[model samples]
Target: MADLAQSAERFRVIARGKLADPRIQSAIDSSTDRLRSHRVDAWDELGEVEERRSRAYEIRMRAIRDIDGNLERFRTALEARGGHVAVCATAEEANAYVVDVCKRHGAKLVAKSKSMATEEIGLNEALEAAGVTSVETDLGEYVLQLENEHPVHIVAPAIEKTKEDVARIFSKEEGVEVPPVLEEVTASARRQLRQVFFDADVGVTGANFVVAETGTVVTVTNEGNGRLVASLPKVHVVITGIERVVERLDDLPHLLSLLGRSATGQRLTSYTHLVTGPRREGEEDGPEEIHVVFLENGRRNLLDTKYEEMLACIRCGSCLNVCPVYRKTAGEAYGPVYSGPMGAVLTPLLVGIDQAPSLPHASSLCGACTEACPVKIPLHELLLELRRDLVDEHETSWFERLGFSLWSFAWSTTFGYRLSSALARFGHRWASRFGPGRVWASDRELPAFAKKRFRDSR
Candidate 1:
């Protein structure tokens, strides 16, 4: 937030590119509509959406409240199963663990499934710096990897790219010419990754949930890449946030139901893998070794706080789909790995609120994210909490503070509110005199305020 001019220029470039994409509206409408519809159908079929929501929220709350105990128990359980566990307090520590493990294993080529935690830690960049070839196996991730861009959406990383854009990327890569059909694009990618996965020395992934009870990691994905990434390489590493660990194995189905409904609108994803420990002595299909790294980064500080419930998010992008600001600005404007309302709240919190001062203010406090969240995170309330942090933590600039203070006093005083309302109404009347409801409004109007203040009418 302090380094203003440079950050502003970066965001301006992102905004211009996103706003210029004519297909953005259609892209959002098509995917969000399908996702929302799928959620409705899935929940209705389940016949106890409310019941599941209640239980899921409670389960997450209980786990996060006793996060330390749960994490310790998880560590013990995972260790007991012959798996090694590492708890990292920062992204640097997590990256160190991965690089050390890869270097120890002499991993020259690495294949990875889609992992937000890896992105959060800039793992690929770190691995590349350490001379490891990290490949993105998930179709969408592969697209972004090819184009050299960050994911624009969660769940659907390449949502911003149309078929033609994808074709351009692949066509250039392959040095071939043809229509950029989805299946064709997929085939080309498959051909490219087939050898990489076959030859990789290590496979890395992110876990959706870590079941402490079973010492297992769960990953749900539509693509089969998660399975390949987990099973093929000699060593498999699962990177995830500490709060993704739920208390009981029984809570999985309830969360799985919500994740599918919220993420892709399916009752279930095509592939749901539950891997416990490394491969057993006789198992031929799974990896020979397994490692789980629970990353705290900054989550322990949120314990018992207002935002603790955000841990229950399950990483579904339902909130993103409905966020108007996210719709307009796209994910790059968030200036972090996470995007949309959740990103707006999470990026600042996990990274450092001071570095991303504008993120919390990007929202309109519309409460759409809260409503759309399958597990019911109060996203708007979280936004307010982040905003309050800026002031309470003294993260605000003098100019912005003065502006907000003036605004707060104006809206708080009845006399000031009334006067301002009258003046705004009068100004609108004067401006509208140019035509009948023909004011030069692009997105909204300077609608007249109430004819009289509420106190007067009452």
Candidate 2:
């Protein structure tokens, strides 16, 4: 919510907290390793994945290129199927749309799946502010709700917290002592959420991929919370970014195949729900009203540009697991809903570089994120582009301008570059003697420069 550059000091502090905590280290390492293995297993199951991944990437790119056309088609399809569609240009607009719908229907309580888009728009908070009680039905989200914290991982929001931590949180919630057994703790949350589901007046969710042909919104989750969140409530509201739409119904199976494989290392998540619209005539049990909110929220600017490819992201969060920075700081450091490399690029663009410019610079430019991306988003390259935008286009601080000026000067000329290289080489001895790199030193090791330059050695 705050400018990340201005908040850089705060982020450094958050990073320090994360770095100092041994529990965070262990939790991140253990969970990421397991996710890594799952991804490998999933990929192995989908052998010939390179070809499949490539095809998936092409489909998304084409869909993005003609996004306006596809979006119109999607809206038409949904309207034809009796779904109410609203286009929101900002998070505020989307939140307002949802709130108005809830108020009009006199919703007292709402149950939600893990909708990062809603989190991005602060939907639950908005509803709470409006005196409408909203419950997070996802197990991970339920834990976060009790703790009053944001999601740490896109896929597993509470990944940073262990069973012991969850048990303690639940103990506080139930007003009783609880043990650290995961199954017992999880079951307790499920029982409570099931009750909430039965009484919910509304259901809110995010679409994984929206099919333009059928005007269908699809959500994949392991816990089956999405099904309850979308099916039980009298009114169902789905929020999603404009980029999620694909060209046709057939393209969905291909993109979804890539999605399941990339996330959770599963051939398929336990539950995948696809809804075309509200329940039609003769429908047994379904929401009486269905609303689809298509949010632009700063995505249109990337169109016809190099960064447009980022729209292909399915939010599998594979990039977060492999991200060196995200591994330590976790998702909160991004100061936004989306985290990791995808967050690094998307946050600055959506929230504005002026609001959170440092996000783009947060990456170590490690290609692991790019490699892990199922849709082939060039995350590393996007970081460089953001850096360029920050320096040249955005209103940057004096220190950054001076630093880049000197950096550019040294890079352009042979003499300046060579001289700086020599000085850097000579400064190696003083590196440790100099002020502690405290921030950089925590996450990585810096090499000491040698005294002799390569050109001067001969």
lDDT per residue for candidate 2 within 1-458, as digits (tens), equals 12223354555767778888999989998998789779978898778867887898899999999998898899899999889988899888998899999999999999999988888888888999889999998999988888788887889898998899988888888887778997889777866777998999999999998988889999999999899889988899999999989989889878777788778887788898999989888988779889999989788988887788888888988999898888888777787477889988888877667777678778889799998998888999999998888778745778658767897989899989988887776664565454553434645667766556678889
lDDT of 1 by residue, 300-342 (tens): 7777777788777788998888888887778778764788899
TM-score computed on alpha carbons, candidate 2: 0.93
Worst 10 residues of 2 by lDDT: 1-10
- Model 2 alpha-carbon drift over 4 Å, by segment: 1-6, 394-419, 431-446, 456-458
Pairs that clash in candidate 2:
none
lDDT at 260 for candidate 1? 84
Query: Whole-model lDDT, candidate 2?
Result: 0.84
Q: Which stretch of 10 consecutive residues in model 1 shows the poorest summed lDDT?
A: 1-10
Query: With candidate 1 superimposed using the best TM-score fit, by how many Å does residue 229's alpha carbon deviate from the native?
Result: 1.0
